[model samples]
Target chain A: MSRLSDLGEFGLIAHLEKILPGGVSKEWSVAIGDDCAVRRSSGGRSEFLTQDLLFEGVHFLPGNSKHWETVGWKALAVNLSDIAAMGGEPVGAVIGLGLPKRAKLREVEALYRGLARAARRFSCPVVGGDTNRSRGGWTLAVTVLGETRRRPLLRSGARPGDSLWVTGELGGASLAWRAERKGKKIPAAMRRRLLLPTPRLEWGGHLAAFGEVGAAIDLSDGLAGDLGHVARASRVGFDVDLETLPRPRGFAGLCERVGVDALEAMLEGGEDYELLFTLRAGAEKAFGDYARSRGLKVARIGRARRGSGIRWFENGREIPRRFGGYRHF
Target chain B: MSRLSDLGEFGLIAHLEKILPGGVSKEWSVAIGDDCAVRRSSGGRSEFLTQDLLFEGVHFLPGNSKHWETVGWKALAVNLSDIAAMGGEPVGAVIGLGLPKRAKLREVEALYRGLARAARRFSCPVVGGDTNRSRGGWTLAVTVLGETRRRPLLRSGARPGDSLWVTGELGGASLAWRAERKGKKIPAAMRRRLLLPTPRLEWGGHLAAFGEVGAAIDLSDGLAGDLGHVARASRVGFDVDLETLPRPRGFAGLCERVGVDALEAMLEGGEDYELLFTLRAGAEKAFGDYARSRGLKVARIGRARRGSGIRWFENGREIPRRFGGYRHF
Candidate 1:
C-alpha cells in the first residue's frame, strides 16, 4: 500500500508535472505557485471554459468512486467529456478538493496520480488549484479550459430531421454500479468500464470537422436525462428504439429481471460519459463509416422530430415514464 | 428584501446570462446547456485556471458571508484575485455551489446578482457550473479561466536583489471579520473594503508588460505565507522593511490597541488577495508609475536575498515571532 509520506504533496505535484506533456513554456505564460495561473490569451483562438463539482454521497457513493485514483481520473474524465461534447480541445484545469480529514494521504496522492495520468493523456496541465480540509464529505471540483478551431457542437443545433448517435456502449455503468452496490460479482471488464471512462476526444474533433454533427451533449447523466436536456433546449422531441442501446456484456438478461426497460437504463442510468449527439439525417452513413474506421460503436438510438418530448419504443408500442430523466438536484 | 424566489435558479441563470456584455450565444462558441465552453486560444497563450472555494464558517464567519449575495461576490472576488496575480486576462468562470436547503430564494438570487456583477465587472462570463443542496453551510467554489500574452509571472523567476512589491493595503478583511463577529459598527467604507475586495486586474497586466516583474503571486493566505511560497520556489530569502508595509485606514490605532505589529497583520492576515510580486531592479519605476496611475497602493515591503527564509524589521532591526505565518491546513 502506498502512503502520502512516501511522496509528499510536492512530490505528488512533481509526479503530475513529470507525466504531463511538454507543451508549456514561459512564453506560453503561466502564473503558478501564488494563488492562480496567470495566462495571456493573446492567441487568436477562442477559449472554452466549464466547471463540474462532485461531492461524495451526492454525486457518487464511496464504492462507486472506488479508489481515490479513480475519483481523480473520473473528475478529469468527466470534465474532458464536457469539452469533447462541445468539440473542444482540453488545455488546463484547476482542481479544488474539499477533503474530509478522515481521508488518507495515500488516497489523495493516488488521486493526483489519476488526475495527472488523464491530464498527460489529454495534453492538459494541472495549472493551479486549492486544497483544504473540510468538515463535511469529500468534494472534488474542477474547472477546465479548452479551445476549438470552429463552431462548437451545441444541443440547440439539432433539427427535426437529425439522427442521434452515441459513442460506445451505455447502461454498463448503471449495471456495474447496481452490481457493485449489491456486492454481486461483476466481470473485470465491466468493473473497469464503471471506473475509467474514455472521453471521446478523437471523435470529437472528427465530428466537429464533419459539420454534420448537430447538437451534442455528453452522457454523464445517462441518455434519457441528457436527451431531455437537449430536447428542452432545442424544443424538439425524440423517439428512441429500445433495441438500439448497446448494453455491456452480461447485463442483457439483468435488464429483464429488473422489470424496467433496458432502454430506460440506457436513457436514465448515468456515468456512461459518452457523446450522445444528433447528426444531419443524410450523414448517417458517413458517421457509420467514421465509427467503423475508428473501431468505435456508433449507434442509431433515436431521431429528432418536430415535437415536444421523448418517447421510447418497446414491442412496436410507446412506453412512457412520468419523469423524463434523472434530476441531480 | 429581494429574494431568490424572485429569480429562481433558472431565472438567476438567465439574469446572469442576460447581463453579460455579450450574452451567451453562438458568439460564445460554446455556451450553457452543454458540458463545457470551447473557444480558440491566443498565440503562445496557455490556459490559466484557478478555483476558489469559499466556506461559510471557515473562510467567512456568519457576519459578512452569512448573506448569500456577499458570499457569492467574495467567492468570485477571491478567484479573480488569483487570475489577476497570474496576470491572466480573465475570460470566464464557473460557480460550484453547495447551498443549504434552509437558504432563502432571495438570498440565492442576490448571490447570483453578485456573481453576475463581478463577472461583468471583470469582463468574464459565468459560463456553466453545478449547484447542489448542502447539509452544511454554503460552499461557493468558483473556478476562473484566464490567459496571458507572453511571459508569465511565476514564483520561480525571482532572483536575488529583486524588489518585492505588494499591490495594495492588506488586513482590512481581518478587521472586517472581527467587527462582524463582535457585532461592532464598522465604518461603511471599511465594511465595503472587507466585504468586497476589488482585484487588481489592471495592475496585473502592467506587471506582465513591464518585463521585469520577475516573479509574482497573489496574497491570499496573507503576505508572509504567500510570499513564503514565492521565496521558497525561487530558492531565495527576503527581508521586509516594516516601514514600507502599507497599512489600512485605522489599522495603526487598531494595532496599538491590540499591542501587536501592524505589519504582521499585513503579513499573516488572510484573504488580502492582493498581488505580491518580485521585480528585477530598474523595473520599479514603471511598476510604481502604473500603480499610481491606477490609484493603488504600492509597497516595497522587502527584497530578495541570496539565502533562504524571511525576516521582518522593527524600525532598523530584525524582529522575531512566535510562529511563522497564517495556517491554512
Candidate 2:
C-alpha cells in the first residue's frame, strides 16, 4: 500500500476526487479543485461554499508561541481567503472545533472573541457549529458560505496574453515565521500580517465585477505554488520577473536580519493570504486607476504565455527552481 | 480559569453562543440553536447548513476497534442526521480531514469509499473540502448543505399535547459500543447500526411536506438529552413512557448478555441516527398510514406538556433519572 507521504497533499486530494462522486446535482456549477464550490442559486446569484482545517501542531503552535486569539483569527481568515479568491462576499460561517479534554473555558472564550472580531470585520456571521472533545490536540474547521452577483472567479480562465497581478506585498509572513522559529521578536506589523491576514474581498469584488479579470487565486501557498495552480488549471505558462515582485515594508531589512534570501522569501513564502490574479493586457491601466481610487496597491509582476508551467526570470535570465512553499505531507 | 470539564459540552456551547454573533444576515431565519441553520433562499426554498466534528480517540478507536471505512461513514452519517432533523434534502457536502503524517493512502482510500457510499445513499454530493496533516490523531469535520420546499422544522415549534414520535429503534448502538470496548464480538446487525447508520431522509421529508409536524431533532445524544433540547426550545414539558420506547430487534437478549438495563439502554443509547419529532394529535393517524405504507416502523413515545423539562414514566409510575448519554467534556 502506498503511504500518504508518497502521494502528498495535492496528490491525495486528486486521488480522492477520482473516487468521490461529483456534479450529482444540477445546482453544482463548480465542484472540487477550485477555491470555493459554486452552486447556482436564485436571484441570479451564485452561492459559494469553502472550508479549511487547521491543526494545533501542523498549522500553529498551541502554547506560549502563539496567542489563542491569533489562532482563532487564522482559522477563519484562511476560509475568508478562499471566499475572496472566488470573488464572493461571505454571509455566514460554521465552525467545527475539536479540543483536548483538558482545555480551559477561559482559553476557549478568548478564542471565540477573536473569531467574533473577524466575523464582524468581514460582515460574516457565525451561524452554527459543532464542538467535541479530542484526545488529540486542537482542531478548528471553518466553513464559510458566500454569494456573488457576477460569475465566480476561477483559476482556469486565464488567457495566454493576460497580465498577472498581485494585491498588497508578500514575504512578511515567511519572515515572521522564521523569526518566531529562532525565538526572535517579530515586528508588530509583520506579526499582524502573519497571524491576522486581511482577505481582499473588496478588491476581488471590483476585479470580478469589472469583467476584465481572467483568473484569481489566494496566495496561501506562496507565490510559486499558487501561481503553479493557476498555470496548470488555465493551461498556460507564466514568466514572472523576480524584480517586479512587491516586497512588504521592511521586508528586505527583515530578510537581512534573519539571514534569509529576499528573493526566495518573496517567491516561496506561504500564508500571505493576498489575491493573485490575471488581467487582460490593456485592463491593467483601468485596474490601476480603480485600485488607486480605492487606496489599494496592486503590482503587475508577470504575464501568461502559450506554454505550460511557471518559470522565474531575473535581469533577463531564468532562475532555476530550488524552493517552494510549505508541504502538508 | 475554569476548565472545559467544568462547563461540559452543552455548557461550553452556550458560553460560546453568548459571545458569538447570531443572525447578522437578513437571510438567516434559524440560527445557532437548531439541528441546522435555516436561511431564506431565492427560490422560496429554505437552505439548511449543519456541521459535525469527529475525533479519533474521543469518537472512535482508530485501528483496533473500527475500520477506517466505518470511521468515515460515521463522520458523514452524523451530519446527514442533522439534515434529516431539519426535514431537508441534502444537496452537497464538504469534508475537512486532519490526518497524522503516518497515515496510509490505502486507508484513506477506504475511508473515501465509505464516504462515497453514504453520499450515494443520501444523494448528497461530496463537493469540496480541505485536508491537512495533523500532529495529533485523526479528525473529520463534515458540513452538509440541504434545502426544503416546506417550512424547515425547528425545536421551538412543539405545542402542548403534541405527540412525540420516533423513527426506528434504539439501544443497539450503545450495546454495540459496550461490546466493542470490552473486545467482545458484536452482533452483525448491531455492528451495522453502530457503524453504518441510515439517515431517515424520506420520512423526514414526508413529515415536513405534510406540514403537521411540530418540533423535530435527531437522536444523536440519546432520548433524554435530545428531548431536553426540544423542551427548552419550545418551553414545553415532556412525559415519556419507558414502555412505549422502541427497542431494536434482539435488544433484550443483547442487554442481558451485556449486563445493561434495557430501559437505560433504550433511553440513553446514542448515535442511533433516528429522527425524534412531535406531531399534532390527530396527525398521528395519517403519519402512521404513511409510515406503514413505506414499511417504516414509527412509535408514539410520549406527548409534550405545559411545563418545561423532560420526565420519564413507567406504566403511570415516574422513574428517576439514572444516567444520560455521552458527554464530550
Best by TM-score: 2
List ranges where model 1 is wrong by over 4 Å.
A1-46, A63-66, A257-261, A320-323, B1-41, B44-46, B62-66, B258-261, B283-294
As a whole number from 0 to 100, the lDDT of residue A166 in candidate 1 is 87
lDDT (C-alpha, whole model) for all candidates: 0.68, 0.86
lDDT per residue for candidate 2 within A1-329, as digits (tens), equals 67788888888899899888764368898888889989988889999999998888778776542388888877888898899998999989999988886677777887898898888889888999999887888889899999998989999889999999998998988888888888787688987898898988887887788789999999998998899889998999999988898997777787888887887777787888989999988888888888898777789999999999888888779988655766788
RMSD of each: 12.5, 1.9
In the order shown, the candidates' DockQ scores are: 0.14, 0.76
Candidates' TM-scores? 0.82, 0.96
Clashes of each: 24, 0
Candidate 2 lDDT for residue A85: 90
Shift in Å, residue A315, candidate 1 = 5.0
B1-329: candidate 2 lDDT, tens digit per residue:
67788888888888898888765368898888899999888778899999988887778666632388888777888888888888899989999988886677777888898898888888988999999888888788899999988899899989998999999997888788888777777689988998898888887887787788999999998888888899999999999988888887777887888777887667787888898999987888888887788776789999999998888888989888655767877
- Model 2, residue B274: C-alpha shift (Å): 0.8
Task: Put down candidate 1 lDDT per residue, A84-149, tens digits, no spaces.
Answer: 887778766767777665665445556777787787778766654566656667777887777676
Candidate 2 achieves a global lDDT of 0.86
